[model samples]
Target: MARHTAFAAICVGICAAGATLGGCDRPAETAAPADVFLANVAEYCGKAFSGRVVANEPPADADPFADKNLVMHVRGCEQPSRELRIPFHVGDDRSRTWILSRTDSGLRLKHDHRHEDGSEDKVTIYGGDTVDSGSATRQEFPVDRESVALFQREGLKASVENTWAMEIHPGNIFAYELTRPGGRKFRVEFDLTEATELPPPPWGHE
Candidate 1:
């Protein structure tokens, strides 16, 4: 009890001495769930991790990614805690990137696709925003009206109802998922415990 009291006294004296700077009694504001999730992912900025297809329904005999290496590079953290652009690399193809950013309401997720010549793909920048306060380790983004319109215009009726989700468990696994009606689902999980070599920047991001 005496040791505890002494520690408390010392803390109090320090606070009193720095009272002009700012009192230690200021109330702490708790970060929202979306913010926490973004921070959790930002912890892996500047690193690249290897991943594998964890789930892919309606399997195809000629899966394009079956024999290719899969990697995800967490980069473009220049926006500080506000945004991150993670490139999804499949072997030598660096055409896909996942852009996650903070929104006034919750969060936003978008897909950026580019050609080898650094040209933007026609059906690119289609994604959605979080509708609720998801947990710190996970967040789900349902197809928004804009993305739906884009898909419809591109004749991608099946993707109009797509819902994408991302999960990040520090030091364990980070997952990306896509689900839609008619039992369509795809998921890839990256091993966060080990970061692989940093790959080249996503196409158009160079």
Candidate 2:
């Protein structure tokens, strides 16, 4: 069907490249499962949706849902490189963005926080990469070494074990979640059925 064609369009070239190399370092690159997954979410580009924190048992160092107006804007996509920039806004603060980029292994997710002056936050670019070929609608990223180092440098030792996830149940729901050491967990789910007008770009992104 057409959906399958789109999947092929996104996945085939990367796969063929792997074969040309005689084999790829990351075997998952052969099928490009994350490529299909990215393509699925890319369908929502330019739209914004509201969400609520469904799970939040915050630890002492954690602040969950301090802002009620939660919005996620699937703002940009570059099909050639397989990248997505989703700005996550909460109330009046436009400081957070979720950057997803394709990799030979799977996918990488980075939390890019910025100051009002468009400067990167001290703890920015901290996140993880997928360890497996996740499904077309879901993916999990375990904290990567670079993120651990960043957290340690920022005195956020507790977040070194962070694990983040994103899910899309086309036309139904889209969700983001975080889990870290010490049983801390936070989750927010967006209603994909109701698309709101796009909000302003996140700080440093405009």
Candidate 3:
């Protein structure tokens, strides 16, 4: 009887250990679906997008493309916008390129300003608040202070307030817009139709 009881207790101990291990693994399995979806979105965004800046606020004084090309592409759209790159130009001059991504805390925006000779002017990173809008995600970063200095340094005499908006369409397009304090707005709509193949970044050079 003593031997039988001892055997039963050992069996119960083994079952308890198995149960504990199973419970520990459950959370990982439950999170897999979300991880997979985000991974897919990131993969899609990793492709370079070729599109024109269809609109702008305050309008460019001269031809928008006469200087250089203003094009945008996504590096990745996962939790981290890891390798996303955006380029802006002024008369054959690539003035600025922005690298940004999403994080658990919020959205991160990095600006790489360059001179005509391919020299780095300034590198700055800005963070903002992010919100999900179901079909699309919106990121709002305060520009009142940062814009004042950045715009001045960049030789753009624009006093902007309120927020900058970046909306992702999940598929092939991403839209960027800036809303100033006085209600003046600038928008860039990126259409991916002309994109033959997606390239990796630094503006995804073919």
| Model 3 lDDT at residue 93 | 49
Tens-place lDDT digits, model 3, residues 1-206 = 43233223333432354422133224322422222222233443444554555566556678555444455645433223223455543324455566555344344455666555556665344323344322224455555456467766766664434466666555556666667655567766666544435332342222
Give the CA lDDT, 0 to 100, for residue 5 in model 1. 38
Q: Candidate 1: lDDT over CA atoms?
A: 0.82
Residue 6 in candidate 3, Cα distance off native in Å: 51
Ranking 2 against 3 by lDDT, winner: 2
Model 2 vs. true fold: TM: 0.84
Candidates 1 and 2 compared by lDDT, better number: 1
* Superposed model 2: Cα runs more than 4 Å off: 1-31, 59-64
What's the residue-level lDDT of 111 in candidate 1?
Answer: 97
Shift of residue 88 alpha carbon in model 1, Å: 0.3
* Residue runs of model 3 more than 4 Å from their true location after superposition: 1-41, 63-70, 76-83, 86-94, 122-136, 144-157, 160-162, 197-206
Better of 1 and 2 by TM-score: 1
Model 2 clash pairs? none
Ranking by lDDT: 1, 2, 3
